[model samples]
Target: MSSDDDPPESDPSPHVTAVVLAAGRGERLRSELPKPLYSVCGRAMASYVLHALANAGVSRAVVVVPPDGRGRLIEQRLREDAPDLNLCFAVQQEPRGTADAVLAAKGQVHTTQVLVVNGDLPLLSAEQIRPVLCHDHNDAVIATAQVDDPAEMGRIVRDSQGRLVATVEYRDADPAERAIREVNLGLYVFRSDFLWNALEQIVAQTRTGEAYATDAIPCAVRNQSAIAVEVELPDGRLNVETPADAANAEAVIRHRIIDRLLDSGAHIRDRNAVWIDAQASVDEGAVIEPGSHIRGNATIAQGSSIGPNAIIEASTVGRNCNLESCTVRGSVLHDNVEVGPYSTIRPGCTIDSHAHIGTHAELKEAHIGEHVQIGHFSYIGDAEIGARTNIGAGAITCNFDGQSKQRTIIGEDAFIGSDTMLIAPVRIGNRARTGAGAVVNKNVPDGGNAVGHPARLTPSRRAHSTTGDEL
Candidate 1:
């Protein structure tokens, strides 16, 4: 990533196009949703693969999908999530093997080098891809991983002269072949010309009756044109096929997200308990406590401390803010704001700097100015309050009238006594005061005082309008 003043690299991106294989129907997972659309941690499974390609500097991609209604739904979501990437869709007309799936993307292939990736690998990273694409002279680059038990994988084959040869799947291999620890992860980078030529010569196996993409290795090797480069990834592939696999992949992604935050100097109290979504951002010096769920474009700025237990969704918290035991959604809290112990701030709310919302308070569609203090056990909805206003405990803004909602305006330096209820379409002027347990239904002019139920004007030092005139 370039700094603010750094000069941009002329072509920092690699000159390779990517084709993501996503036509697989994962019956093992036993879910109605498509495999590519399955939720992995906080995002769809295929989105991680697309992000890896983008981070690896692959500018354009073609995602292969089935020609079904589900594919259209997936396409809509992909466009919404990744609008910057130049995405094109290719329909795999039927259920086929890897080689046949690659052929579906024939029309979209334009670059000299092509990266073929499995869409199920949600844990794929750009660092794991660079080793394969970095080899300029290699005809093909295969990514392999080492596992303790190499079951249900293709073992890498070598010749007598210790040269790279082919990959033999465990189902078709003999005893010795299945023992090899290094297995193919079904990810490859290939030269465009060799990819097209080698895939055409593949013969379908009798067991599956499908043309395997692995057959390309032996074809290239037999021609004495195979230059295979292998990369052994440390994290391995997080491909999901079953329910258990989905849980494991979700755990891995959760760790990865938290680890990235820790590495960037964010303080998290308990690493295992917090759930930070894929797109959430926490600045340096921010603190995230245990049992917090941060999701959907949530950003915690520097010097902010959030939750021992809280949920923040699609909200922004400014610097030096503090929140605890609260849920905030689609709202903005400015600098030095203090919310919660137990509060719910809903959408379309703006809390200005130095405002304090005490415990058990809720605000929806409200604009609160600076230094305003709303005590505990209150509900303020569809209201606008000026700066330096002190709202008493158990206050309620009755802004809803069963048919339509209305707004209330409270001016600066106004003092409301405890348990006061301000009715809809009401205005309290600057320096106005309300008595305890007052049910206010009319506007009070500047320096006016209201008292009792269906409140009447109280005696004041300066004369003021008690005629409920709205400014």
Candidate 2:
């Protein structure tokens, strides 16, 4: 009843629990935030690994964190990002090593198999992780990749006829072992019993006094324990530790997201100039112009055209909408809305359908009704405009008078004149009219007319009939 590409109905390996190594203090990044909490494509870097584990059908996880302030922050962010996965935390008391980090999580992992992974890898995916989960017959399975340059990676050493020899770190390997091309990818799956026994036997390396996970492989070989080495291509194994690595990870993630958008019928003219976050959703038939950034769960509905230099964050843009050279944050624009160049829509603003916002207009905390027209160079804040209202050029809503912010309410079918200033706590009734340069400080009744500075209410003006008489 379903295609082969569809995800399975249940978890493939529910007996496998993941142990994520994240307690390391990354000093090379020179950031106050923890390395695992660093942002990659507008998401925490470690979230990718957790998502990969979920994709591989491993839902239960125990994240190992340092026993400090960094651990609390990492735990909180991971909980927010990957809430679907059943997760718990384990504290690594000291900066011992990867092996020690895994051992710290031993108490939390109750599954038959344990999946160990590094949290700094932002480019990891489900396809790369699923293969290691398949080889469950062996006591331990280590994922290996062949790279063009194995500069400082741990090498997978083998004896004559290519039998398993040992996993040697670059700092501790001989010349022959260093020349081997196959390197450890730092993704491993081990049986729970074998892992606990092997990790306990590993001694700290003399050079760094740290017990590396790579040392467990040699112990398995020496003890004649069944071990499997799964070979995969070098694609999504970038471990981000520095600024350069972070940039590379972001570029790879952006490319993948752009490719997905293109495949889903979205039009991106200049891919090189746009930066979209991983959480953004661009529907089919949407056109994204150059220099645009759609970030933080923003949604662009179908038939919408987003600009040649627009920054939309945490907003929703409806169908057939056009936004050009604007910055919209935390706002909602309904269908058939048109926002002109250099307009800024700040938080808590909602523009209804058929509304036309002219160039250089700024709105904040304002609720605009249907068919509303706001002309150029206007600033409307803390205001609510009714349907079919026409706000003229350079109109201002002086809602803040130094002490507190007040509200401006304009009724339906109102015509606000050019350069008009409506002072705080003012109300303009339905069908009311204001002359150019009027500064109104009081309320106007329905169908009334206000003119001149410190505007006073006057008699309603009637429309002229075809016979030259007032209607």
Candidate 3:
């Protein structure tokens, strides 16, 4: 029979159900969060795997997560992040073997064949995944890797005819099996019925109290089923478990993102100085100075200038924003905002048009409106400054108490002097003024002025607030 006339060897509807095993606690990662939820290049580590599977024609998926609050959170996040992909969740109530995890999603596996992928392999791609699933075999077709050191991995034992016989674990393998360089990479494609039968046989072996997927391979081989090994591309298999592995995965992802950006018409003056992600966009006229790293879905609009030494991540910079020698992340800047030689714009900041963030200034979760000026050596966090406001040198909004956070609001056309400190949950109204070395703890009404450590109000001024407030 022709490939199409035969029973569906692979998913023909561009819809294969993927079983992603993410039930492990990943204790070696040493994080409170699950390893799959950890980031790689800008996205969750598991997201890359999901994307690859989706691209490889898996329309639906059942991610097997641990029975914990973290796992539920991961499922929710994946749903929100990749809404286009039809994804479901399956709970592995206990720490079981990989085969048990797959069986947890047995109800969801309706396709003729199922694609099983490891959650930790962040570098795997659709091109590599598709070929393994396309193999026409009555038995399981596993993606295998030829590693230099196969000491820890399960050995892929093949017969003289080069048909895969079994996968022997390192501890159980004989010397002859130990010499094989081909190792099971934990990615596989199996005929649905054969897989179900193998899993049933594996569960019957629970007398040992530990059920393993590798055990199923031997069962299939005993039944005279064909087990084949599909060699994977060298660059496709990277398993992240420990911190060192995470670091290596990060480097690999970084290189991939950089290469993709370069191919997409992004200019890097010095490869060492610049780190741009695959998803970030930089116009041709935009100049990314040396020692600048733009990461995590950030975009530098046309005519924008990034630092001689700056880092920007998970943020958006509009046209002509002068970001020189600063670190910005999870912030948004409108057009023509000037961030200076030494500044840190932390997460949740929104700097409006013509705002000036000067040298040594640090802002976190603050909103600086149009034409606002935040001068040197100031710290503004959890604050909202209105249009045409002026924040002087050495001024700080004390946002964090010993226990919690607070907010500071400066109204339109407000002028705050040097060495001023605004404590939490405070407000300065429109056109308010503060004298030099003022410590503001209370709200100042519009067209008012204040001075001293515990700031007091001054007489109203009809004239508009100018100078330090203007861009």
lDDT of each: 0.80, 0.83, 0.77
- Give lDDT tens digits, candidate 3, residues 1-471: 000001112334353577888887789899887888877666677777887776666677889998879788889767755624578889988876888888899987787777788887877777667777666465666778787766567788887888877888889888888999888877777778888888877877687655866566666677776566566656534677778777777777666665554555555677665666545667656777888888866888877889888998879899888999999999999999999988999999999999998999999999999999989999999999999999999998898778899999889998999889887777788888888888777666677678876876543442333433221
Candidate 2 local accuracy as lDDT? 0.83
- All candidates: CA RMSD in angstroms? 4.1, 5.2, 6.3
Candidate 3 lDDT: 0.77
lDDT of 1 by residue, 368-470 (tens): 9999999999899999999989999998999999999999999998988889999988998888888888888988787778888977677662267745253
**TM-score for model 2?**
0.89
Error of 3 at 468 (Å): 28
Winner by lDDT: 2
Which of candidates 1 and 2 is the stronger one according to lDDT?
A: 2
The positional error of residue 370 in candidate 3, measured at the CA in angstroms, is 1.7
lDDT of 1 at 201: 61
Q: Worst 10-residue stretch by lDDT in candidate 3?
A: 1-10
Task: Give the TM-score of each candidate.
Answer: 0.84, 0.89, 0.83
Q: lDDT for model 1, please.
A: 0.80
* Alpha-carbon deviation at 440 in model 3, angstroms: 4.7
